[model samples]
Target: MDSPEITEAMDALRRRLVPGTRTILGIAGTPGSGKSTFATWIQQQFGPGTAVVVPMDGFHLGNAVIEGTPLRRRKGAIDTFDAGGYLSLLRRLVRRDEPVVYAPEFRRTLDEPVAASIAVPADIPLVITEGNYLLADQEPWKEVRAQLDEVWFVDTPQELRLHRLVARHVSFGMDPAAAVAWAAGPDEANALLIQATRPAADRIIPWEQELE
Candidate 1:
């Protein structure tokens, strides 16, 4: 979206705010659908201190936890995350009791979660969290919808999203052929699951419409 349009959307979200309460806005979509980019844009509109971005990727179970388990091969699957921990953080964010709440962050290069990397202060009114499973219907995941005031699903053409996913994998150290294979395999599988949760989102954001 253009700057003005982004500002307008941010304003609409702000209008939903209630005094002394914090709101979480979820940006959900399949891998490479631009959820993270859109969430970052929204955070920029709000600026520092007014809002923060707490990505669901941050809650990914470390390599240690998944190693030698069935989940190791399915790293990006819903089962690979620490769902309970993520839920607890959301609960705390809603209560707004603590002066500062720390959130973990996922490092793409290291392929591991860094503990307490992002801090959400008490006064920040909006928390923008982006991920693939926010609208999922499965246990633990089903409860994710309840923690957010609003959820926006980013939609992009399947071909383009797949291309982006492949490129992303390559950029992160995978060989071109391996990147393409992984994107078409595991990434596509997760995308199918995430796509099934689309109807549950509060809004659908077309990638072209939002970024053009």
Candidate 2:
């Protein structure tokens, strides 16, 4: 989207805030739909010190934990995340009383979560968190929506999304054939789940339009 459009959205979000309280803006989308890219654009627009981007990828369960369970093959499925832990962090961010709150970050190369990697200071008024399940209706996930001031669903063409997902799997070490298979299989399943939560969002962001 153009700078004016972005600024207007940000302005509208800010208008919902009461002085002295922090607000979280959630960007929810299917895998490869550019949620992270949009969140980064928001952070850049707000500039440093005023905002921070805390991603949901950090809450992914360790490989060891996943390998021991039925969820072993479904690494990106809803059950593969630490939903309670993520919820706790959201609570902390809303409280914002701590001098600084530390959050984990996911290392794509290692496919692991590194603790205390993202530091959210007391002074930052806005926290942009993006993920696939923020608007899910399943138990704890359903509660996640209440923690955020607003959630925006990112919409991208299914074919393009799947292509990017396959490329991402390849970049992360999967063989080309295996990557395409996994993207079409597991990733596509998760994408369907994510899409069901679209109506739960406060706004819909057109991914292709934004790129233009």
| Angstrom error at residue 40, model 2 | 0.5
Tens digit per residue, CA lDDT, model 1, 89-111: 99999889899999999999999
Model 2, position 124: C-alpha lDDT score? 87
The RMSD of every model to the true structure, in order and in angstroms, is: 2.4, 2.2
Model 2: lDDT to the true structure: 0.87
CA lDDT for candidate 1: 0.87
lDDT per residue for candidate 2 within 128-205, as digits (tens), equals 999999999988997888899899988889888877888788888999999998988888899999999899888888
Off by over 4 Å in 2: 3-8, 14-19, 209-212
Worst 10 residues of 1 by lDDT: 203-212
What TM-score against the true fold does each predicted structure earn?
Answer: 0.93, 0.93
Alpha-carbon local distance difference test for all models: 0.87, 0.87
